[model samples]
Target chain A: GAGVSQSPSNKVTEKGKDVELRCDPISGHTALYWYRQRLGQGLEFLIYFQGNSAPDKSGLPSDRFSAERTGESVSTLTIQRTQQEDSAVYLCASSLARVPYNEQFFGPGTRLTVL
Target chain B: AQSVAQPEDQVNVAEGNPLTVKCTYSVSGNPYLFWYVQYPNRGLQFLLKYITGDNLVKGSYGFEAEFNKSQTSFHLKKPSALVSDSALYFCAVKRDDKIIFGKGTRLHILP
Candidate 1:
């Protein structure tokens, strides 16, 4: 793909429902990252995946948020028992590799609205 | 933990005038700085980055940033502003293999 792509650009789910957001990073990128942006707030780190290494999950806000990446390719962010507070834009990014500092390309983002 | 700060919530500039969006960072070891811009209802676009070497780095859309190691700052600047340049800008730092982003500053260029 020319750039990172995210599915379900906008989603509206009822409270307590489980929702999954999908992301397809740029082909050949070895690092993938997930972030959340609440209204009028900055982007908060969620998770990171680097090749075959164990993912860094330190940024996950709580047990309800989890994510997985397959072979440095596509990734999925799943929210369990979604709450109205969970409503926000979920962003996915990818980099060539997880070095000291690498340029990350970002997707448009999925607007998750928990009604 | 590493973090970035974009002090201003918003900045307004007139077309053809110089513009600046302030940014400061905290990190361990050297910093890998970056600037990104976001348009309404769109994804973020990378403007430029400063990895190492020269203090000044240039990037897409005629944007540039100056890396001040002493000051721990990397502010985005443009010689002349355009109305089309109105957007949200973010400053980020790469530390310990993790990229941390700032709150972001909304920039408005008045025509």
Candidate 2:
């Protein structure tokens, strides 16, 4: 696709259930990022993947949250034991070359609602 | 830690009037400032960025932002506002591989 795409546009999960959100970045883009937008709050960085380098997980809120990207193509974000606080929109973005000035292309986002 | 701040929760402007959304940042190294806009039920779209040379950066949708190093601000501006321009605006600063975003400001364009 010409732009970044995300799957499961909306998800409703139980408190104890686990969920996975998917992201397909722009073809050949080297940098992919995940962020969470909570109600009444800003976009919080989740994780970042730049090519073959180690994915930066510093912004991840907890151990239950994890994400993986394969060969700069598709990425999946998994959350275990879904909590009410985890309900938010998960956004994904990708940039052309991971350079300093490059702007990111964003997906429509996956809205997760935990019940 | 890197941080971004949008002091105003909402800004209202009349249609055809000029508008400005203020943003400020705190980062360790040089700042890579950016502005993004979000329509309801949609993801954020990049507006413009200030990476280096010029302090004034123009972006999509006739939006422009000025970068001030001393004040650490990257304020987004538009010469005219339209009813369709009403949306949420976010200011961000890139630190390392991640970008820190402000709380966002809701722009209301009154007719």
Candidate 3:
């Protein structure tokens, strides 16, 4: 589709398991971002991938959360040893670039339920 | 640090009447403001943004926002409210290349 797309719209996993979320950004977009939204809370920045340079992983919650982008294209967010606290809607967004003025297009998101 | 605030958790308005959703922000440098709306079980849709042009920025769905640098506010406004306009609204501010969002405000348009 023209907009950003995320796989496994909903996922339920057992505690201590591992899960991966995928994101396909809009065609030609040079920047990608990952964010998590907890119930009744605002969006929390997770990571940002800009071109081929090192991703901005500053917002990652913990060491268990890691993400990688393949040549400025599709990106995947991996969660190791999933915990109940990890349950949330993981959102993916993409933009033309990292400029503040750039408008980001968001994907439907994957709702992860770690029980 | 950079942050955005939407004071009201929800705002109720009558159909055809003017509406306003308040938003305030703080950042280290010149602020980059934005408004996004989300419908049920859907991702946020971009509404309007304030970069460097006029204080009032018009966006999709006939929505508009005014950037008040002196007041540190960027309030979303619409001349006529529609029931379809009811949704969750988020205000954001960009600082140091990070875009921070507010808690969000839920708008309900009474028919």
Task: Using lDDT, give the best candidate's number.
Answer: 3
Task: Kindly indicate the candidate among 1 and 3 with the higher TM-score.
Answer: 3
What is the TM-score of each predicted model, taking all chains together?
A: 0.96, 0.96, 0.97
lDDT of 1 at B97: 69
lDDT of 1 by residue, B12-47 (tens): 999999999999999878888889898998898888
DockQ of each: 0.69, 0.76, 0.75
TM-score of chain A of each: 0.97, 0.96, 0.98
Judge candidate 2 at residue B70 and give its lDDT: 96
Identify the leading candidate in terms of DockQ: 2
Interface alpha-carbon RMSD, every candidate: 1.5, 1.4, 0.9
lDDT tens readout by residue for model 1, A50-92: 9999999998999999998889789999999999999999999
Question: Which candidate achieves the best TM-score against the true structure?
Answer: 3
Worst 10 contiguous positions by lDDT, candidate 1 chain A? A95-104
Cα shift from native, residue A93, model 3 (Å):
0.2
Model 1 residue A16 CA deviation in Å: 0.8
Tens-place lDDT digits, model 3, residues B1-111: 548999999999999999999999988678899999989988999998998989999999999999999999999999999999999999988867767888889999999
- Greater lDDT among 2 and 3 belongs to 3
What is the C-alpha lDDT profile of model 2 across A25-106, one tens digit per residue? 9998999999999888889999999999999999899999999999989999999999999999999999986746788889
What local lDDT score does residue A5 receive in model 2, on the 0 to 100 scale?
92
